[model samples]
Target: MAPGPAPGPPGHAAPDLATLTGVRSGKRSYYRAYVRSDERMQRAVRAMDSISRALVRTVEGPRGLLEEVARAAAAHLDASWTILALSDGHLRGARPRFLAVGPDGVVTDDDAGLAPLVRRELGAIRAGHATRSDDDGPWVRVPMTLEGRQIGSLVGLHGLDAAPEPGDLSVLRILANQAAVSLHTSEQYQAGVALHRRAQRLYDEATAQARDLEQRTQELRQAEQRLVLAHQRELIDTERHRIARELHDSVTQYVLSAGMAVEVARGEAEELGADGTTILERLGTAKQLSQDAVEQLRRAIYALHQSHRDTVSTLPELLHEVAEHHRPQLQVQVRVEGDVVPLTTDADHEIARAVGEALFNVATHARATRAVVRLRYRADELLAAVADDGHGDPVELSRLLRLERGRSADGRHRGLANIETRIVDLGGGIVFRRARLGGVRVEMRIPLPLTPTDRPGVISGLVGTPGDDRDDRSGDDTQEDPWPR
Candidate 1:
């Protein structure tokens, strides 16, 4: 409509200026469209790179990954402030862990104004609703989800000059979803560790209880053994008491009655004049022996029972008494070979009784004209022996003392068995050997204190050996005294 172009050479028409202007405007439109497309592609590539970096932080655990997500979302969305809040009800009395990024890089607030909006997004996620931007403010909240369950919320605050686009919201959603997965994995690991610790504690307690039960079992076994030993001791004491009663009632009474009979016979023989003098003297001796037997019986009964506080006589005097009483019945000589010492009551009684039993064996069993009673007192021990000039076998006497047979036909074996029992009970020793007097020797030794005491007490006598109760009158009637001067 304005000017015309000059026509070119042959066949060319003149160009219109309006047509040239329209061509230039079309080229400008194409250049503008190409520039806009290139910018959009660059933005897409950056968002993709941000999401890849946030996912890589999941290896550092849930808390670290959450922090990374906040930073990445802030840069990608161009926000003035960003917050990532996690709320897992598993922790005791736990509140949400909140992380934020601001213009200065990182920021935190306990009571932030945007906290309510973040919590609301979390509620929406739990309620199965889509997370969206707020219409009232330049902020956006997106749900953090794992396997379709909401774990927390991701909230971003945009600057006054910056508003979020659809692409910005999409990048935040990817970060929140990856954070939820990391949180779930961390929770499972913590639970497994707790369960292992609990199991170990239970095993330790069970081991301690087992040890206690084993110790209790051993104590019970020891207690049971002690009870068994106590019961055995009680039975032995009961048997000892029964034997004491039998000797007191029967044997003692019989010996006393026999002594009375011998006295009566002596009286009757005295009426026969001069011929009865020898018979009366022999009867008198028999009566004396019978009384001695009765005394020995009483002592044996006492030894079998409990001790008493009654004072006793000295050891030498007690032995002399036994010799003096038995002299009329048998020709017995008393000999003392060492210094005399006092002894405890039980030891004194047992030693004197053992010597008496040896002498009685010579009188009742040995066919000898004379016998010797030797008492040797030493610093450490008291030794006593009785020997005869008869033919008693030492081996046979030892067998009888051991009670190889219950009782002899003559009832003499019981006496020697009693001697063996008494010697063993007193912790003494006994032996039978050939004597210097050419007959059986019954020797015994009793221990004494290394240092003598001032206390003095009497020794008691024994009745007879086990095999010598029945009188054997085969020895000659000759009487001789071999006692030391």
Candidate 2:
């Protein structure tokens, strides 16, 4: 255009100051673009490195991790201040804790009023809504999500020349992801520790309860043992006293009677002067009394060893012993009918005791010359009766039996109540009636089980003839119900 430039090479331009200057200026612009791109990549790498390091340090504590996240976000985003708020309300005491960081250090902001705003943003992000716009605003809200669950928010306040660029938002999003993972991991670890502590406390309480129960069980065992030992000692004492009373009442009385009979025989021999026949008769009588005493002694010794003996006592033998025991006091006779059944030791003893008591009462109160004991064995039961031939007041005897609480005038009524109790306990019933012999008759009937049971139970009502016109009293009057006192 200006007289044309010098001829240039084919398809090439001529050298000129303006062209050289333009080429140099293009190279400068390209170099400047490359340098700026390299600087941005380096800054992004450093920011990622910082985020990685901050996430690694999140294991220290929940508060420490929050503070680290806040600091890293503030520095990376070039913000005046950054806050990490737990929008899920995972904090203890249900109080919101906002961790804020600035360029200088950690700072406290009175953002209690902003809690509602932060929650709204977090809800919107969790619900998959578009992010809130804050292009020209001083506050930027970004959700911190993990596994697609929004845990909290990262709110930053800053004064920049322009709105946040895409690169800034990218870095902030990467940091938010890391922070969500770190915070979630830290919260999980804390929850695991709390659960473990609670389980340990419950285990300790159960162990303590087990120990106390074991101690109480041992104490109960010891107490039961002591009670058993005490019961055994009491039983031994009772058996000893019973043996003493039996010996005093039976053998001792027989020996005394024999001594008196010997003295009488000696006096009769003295009265028969030169009469050897009468003397021999008196000596024979003394010999018979001595023999009776010896027989009683033998019976007493047998009773003392009754526990170790296996011999079963028959009903006839029991009645014979009762008759023999009271032979000296009255003309006691025993009559047996039917087959004699074998009885238990307790039954035999109680039966014999009742017979002895009835005979003794006849001798002491009836003033009868003859007393008879009749025993009969039936298919399912046994019956025994003691009768005397004398006139005795049945009404007075019934009154005495009813008023047993009063002491007897002569102790003659002793053991009458015991006889009643023993026969009742053996599933037997006793009745007082007027005998055909014109005296009192005491009759008893006891039941036997089909299978031979050891335990004895009471059968209601007495089964026998009424004693006298005055002896007709109800069964209730004999057992639990008392006659009008």
Candidate 3:
């Protein structure tokens, strides 16, 4: 065992009482000092109170406690190495990181405990038991406690020349106790930080997954539109063929009879010889008009077949019509970027109508002086945007779409439903947002040659409803003007 404190001349006053009470040990030395000393116990208590306040103010948690104790021990005892260690529920480190100091006045982590006396002393400190080594001035360890609960340890090596007096040892124990409380607080704080990180990771992963799913859904919708377009074109061709047979059976007979009547009248006029020239000219003009109708029908059939040879439409021609008709002062712009496959008739029709609707919405809602229209032909679909510079929030576009459904004056309403429905039918959609110009903006997209296989049930469900047998005859009359004053 380590040698006891040498019997002292006069009473040995403790150098630091804060350490003694904090460690929950070494009360006997203080009790003896209080009883025989001329100074009252109150004076000792007052001095310790000041030291305790200072230690508490500087400490954070167990880590702070351990560090403070080690620094105090190292400076007072003048030992080459002083260390304090505590586990954070992990046992991997060969030595604890709570605190450590090495010989030669240098602090290092890799030091091994070579003396059993030191090990036993440290073990007792962690276990809330005070212990001393066998050397004359050996290492001492004492457990730091708060409210009777063991938190960690305080350790110090007593150099041969710097053995601690009873009062000094008591002060060291008190510091150890305070350190234990700080360590517990720090551990709890670390645990909270770890949990916050885990939660953030989960949120990021979930957001990525949602975006992936939305992209896949858009692709599927585009494919379905291609399939519906093919079916509609085929049906239109069949209906035209049927109409051709009807024209041959009914119209051809009527036209031939009428031409014969005209010929007979012309002959009569010529035989009469008075107004032959005028009568003959009238007959010829009527015959020419009849023939022109037949030729026009023939040309329409050729125009329909031309799509098979060249699948793309002349987009500039289509937009020119809308631009030509647009109101003055509103600049309608159309820019085609690259080569893209021609969209089906329905897709083309729906896109055009949606764009027109977007323009209408802009004209009524935005009070901007100028507006811009943009069209981009990607490899897959047609993207069109109608934007105005009146007022626009770049993101709050969906709310505007809802407003379009509501009524203003005269109970009149804006028809966003037409735009949305048509966009959806073409395997595309419209989204409203702030335009680059500072006004309301509307974007419309339609996939080319959309296929039903992309959305198997959709084309079958929407195009051919339960009682609808005449798909060949069904088509939108979008050629007619939407607004007629």
Poorly placed runs, candidate 2 (over 4 Å): 1-40, 55-59, 89-97, 107-136, 244-485
State how far residue 330 of model 1 sits from its true place (Å): 33
Ranking by TM-score: 3, 2, 1
Q: TM-scores across all candidates? A: 0.41, 0.42, 0.48
Which of the two, 1 or 3, has more lDDT? 1
Q: What shift in Å separates residue 341 of candidate 1 from its native position after superposition? A: 42
Best by lDDT: 1
In order, the Cα lDDT scores of the candidates are 0.64, 0.62, 0.56
Clashing pairs for model 1 are: 312-458, 313-457, 313-458, 314-458, 412-466, 413-466, 415-466, 416-465, 416-466
Task: Put down candidate 1 lDDT per residue, 188-256, tens digits, no spaces.
Answer: 766777788888898899899999889999898657645543443344346557877887788778888
Off by over 4 Å in 1: 1-61, 87-98, 102-104, 107-133, 159-170, 219-237, 243-485
Writing each residue's lDDT as its tens digit, candidate 3 over 393-464 gives: 645557756775564555445567678866786678777766667776677776644653343342244464
Best by TM-score: 3
- Select the stronger candidate by lDDT from 2 and 3: 2
Candidate 3 lDDT trough over 10 residues, lowest sum: 466-475
Candidate 1 weakest lDDT stretch, 10 residues: 459-468
